[model samples]
Target: MNAIEIINLTKYYGKNRGIIDVSLQVKEKSIFGFIGPNGSGKSTTIRTILNLIHPSSGEAYIFGKNCEKEYNEILKDVGYLPSEVFYYSNMKVIDLLKYSASFYKKNCDDRINYLSKIMNLDLTKKIEDLSFGNKKKVGIVQALLHSPKLLILDEPTSGLDPLIQQNFFNLLKEENKKGMTIFFSSHVLSEVQKICDEVAIIKEGRIIKIEKINNINNNNYKRIKIEVNYKIDDTFFNNIEVTNLIKEKNIYTFMYKGEINSLITKLSKIDIINIWIDEPSLEEIFMHYYDEKM
Candidate 1:
């Protein structure tokens, strides 16, 4: 069974729009990335999947059970961390975590302590006394203490330091390896590139693309730089499937997508002093998506 499935899901608030026909499928034990600009319905889709808010049309299912009808039972195996977290200001950090753990049947004290140590959290402090980063750590611990089957994170790295973010990602990889499926929602394309097996890109409250990370990169344009021993005519690279080609004395650089043999054959005619070829970053590919829509 899929970890999460949405069949033409749509939601509306009075006359306001939420999402439209947002169909998606997250396979079990897979780390799926959900990406979009702010207010683009990423959160709305997640909320509907969790059954936090009702959808006006279509339906969502988790582990083959209808989300709207089986949310109570589903919650037992799910952990969620929102873009923003809120808690009783007066409560101590440890107290708040204990209260949250109470909702689950397992005794999570040892798990709580273990997570706190790894996250470098001070559970003795009052909730109001912690910084935003610390509070986010608390949320991270809260979500993982029960070793849930599924983890839903929304902009989960906000306010986290670089070291903490690295540690957090490593921890997530460990959990995912242990059979916990993950749904990561964020605008940070770099992180998604590094972690997700497949990515779903949403724009203007609609899903525009869903594909494997490898598939996206395999067809990605390559950036090439060459320094010939002698200068070449401007039209020498004509019909070579290049973009952004620039020439400076003996150097020529551009983005290439055509056959490598064609490029090598052309370059063999010249005395090349230096050459460089590299894969474009995920950020470049992400920008290509938005640019094409324009």
Candidate 2:
């Protein structure tokens, strides 16, 4: 069964479009990545799914229940962490957690204790006194303490240190192993690449591509920098699909597409001194998509 399903969902604000005809299904027990640039409607879609805002058109469903008609029941099994967290400044961490826990009838102390130890969160400090990163830790604790079946997190790593971020990811992996479904939204491609089983890329309020993480063409291209014994004319590399070419004396740095064997075969005839190949990063792949949209 799908953990969440959105069908032809659309939203608008006055004359501006928020999202249009966006449809997606998140499978059970999978980490799904909702990726887009800022203001691309990722948050809008999430808010609509949570029933925090009414959709202008279309429908959203949680576990086969209509989002609007069964919001209370649906929310009981879900935990959400918004991109921006706002807490009462004067409240202590323990107090805030206790207050949040009051909404559910079951005791949550065990879950809270487990998460606090794993995240290394200090519950003694007041919300106002905690650092930004620590406050994020508190948010993480609250979101996971209930042990909700469906977890929705938006930019969850905003203020976390590198170490804590790694720990949090480890925790997510553990949770997924027990059959939890996670839908996380972020523009950080590297983090998404690390944890998500599947991803959907949105551009200009529309989802342009959806693919399994393992299916991505990570081997798109390579960059080669060669130091040649003889100076070559610029036209020698013109028809070679070369990009970002930099030449200094007899050395040339350029990007190449396709197999290395063909390029190597051609370069073998040249008097070459040394060469190095650079692989493209996830950021470079994201930028390629963004540029296509523009």
Candidate 3:
């Protein structure tokens, strides 16, 4: 069974478009990445799925329950960490966490203490005294305290430092091992590439492509950079399979996805000083999708 299913989900705010006909399914026990640049409706899609914001059209399902109509029941097994963290300034971190835990039926004290130790959060400090990153830690603990079957995170690493970020990723992996489904939404490509089993690329509030990470990494796309003895025409390497082609002085760079022999055959005629070809990074592949004209 799919953990989450969004069917042609679309949302609008007044005249502004939130998402347009976005459809995707996240498999059970998998880490799914929803990637897009800022303001491309990543949050909107997530909000719609959680029924935090009503969709203008279409619907979403969580564990086979209608998200909009049965949100109360669905939320029991769902843990959510929004992009922004907020809390009462005067409340102690521990007190605030206790309050959040009260909403769920099970005891989360042990889970809370364990997560706080891992995240290095100071539960004794007042919420107002904590740094932004520390507050984010509190949010993280809150989200996981219930040991929810599904965890949804939006821009989770925004305020976390590198070491903490890796630790958090490790924690996520551990959770996944226990059969928890994770929905990770972020604009950063490398993190998504590293953590997600499958990723859906969103641009201008629409999903352009969805693929497994292995297929994306193992695909034949190559990052090619050529340095010739002299300047060359910009279109010299133009091909249907080439994207982001650019020429600056004696250097030419682009992403290619086709037969290597065909590319080398054309290069054989040119006076090349050096040529470099390597697998394209996920960021480059993301650019290739964004750089395309819609």
Candidate 4:
């Protein structure tokens, strides 16, 4: 059974588009990544699913229960971390955690302690004293304390340092191994690429692509620069599948998209001394998609 199902789920805020005809299903025990830029309705969709906000139309289900009707029951087995962290400033870290843990019937001290150590959160500090990163860590601990079956985290690593971000990923992976379903929402391409098994890219409140991460064409075009001992004919540019070609003296730089075998064969015929090929990063790939949509 899918852990979550959103069928034609849509929301509108006074005629302004929140999301339109959005439909998605997250499989049980899988890490699903929801990706989009700002004002793309990601948070709106998440809130609707959690029943924190009412949807104007369509339906959402968690564990086969209607989201709106069964919100209380569904929430009992779900943990959520919002995009923003808010708590009483005067409360100590331990006090805040205890208050959050009180919502669940299960004892959460051991889980809280374990997470504190794993995340390196200082329980003695007051909420107001913690840095942004530390405050996010506290939010993480509270979300996991009850050992919820499903975790919904929105921009979970926003303020975390690199080390803590890595640790958080490890924690999610470990939880998934124990049959937990993780729904991770983020705008960061690298974060989604590294941790998500499947990802859905949303733009302007619409899903543009939803596919297995392995299926994405991450092998984008490469930029190649070549320098030869002798000046090669400009005719080389004519035969080569090159874009944005630049030539000066004996040096040439261009972008190539197809198989490298043919390009390599052509290069071998020339007295090439220096060469460089720039591979695209995740950010570039994401931008490529974004540009295509525009």
* Winning candidate number (lDDT): 3
lDDT of each: 0.89, 0.87, 0.91, 0.89
RMSD of every candidate to native, in Å, equals 2.6, 2.7, 1.7, 3.3
lDDT by residue (tens digit), candidate 3, 1-294: 899999999998988999999999999999999998999989999999888899999989999999999999999999999899999989999999999999999899999999999898899999999889998999999999999999999999999999999999999999999999999999888999999999999988999999998888887689999998777765665544677877788788888887889889888888889999988889988888787745
lDDT of each residue in 23-79, candidate 2, tens digit only: 999998999999988999999999999999888999999888899889999988899
Error of 3 at 134 (Å): 1.0
Q: Give, for candidate 1, the lowest lDDT window spanning 10 residues.
A: 283-292
For candidate 3, give the lDDT.
0.91
lDDT, model 3, position 233: 62
Residue 246's lDDT within candidate 4 is 75
Candidates in order, TM-scores: namely: 0.89, 0.87, 0.94, 0.85
lDDT of 4 by residue, 43-158 (tens): 99999999999999999999999999999999999999989998899999999999999999989999999999999999999999998889999999989999999999999999
Off by over 4 Å in 3: 233-235
When summed lDDT is taken over every stretch of 10 residues in candidate 2, the lowest stretch is: 280-289
Clashes of 2: 0
TM-score for candidate 3: 0.94
Model 2 regions lying over 4 Å from their true place: 217-279
Residue 264 error, candidate 2, Å: 5.3
lDDT of 3 at 66: 97
lDDT of model 4, residue 227: 89
Candidate 2 vs 3: which has more TM-score: 3
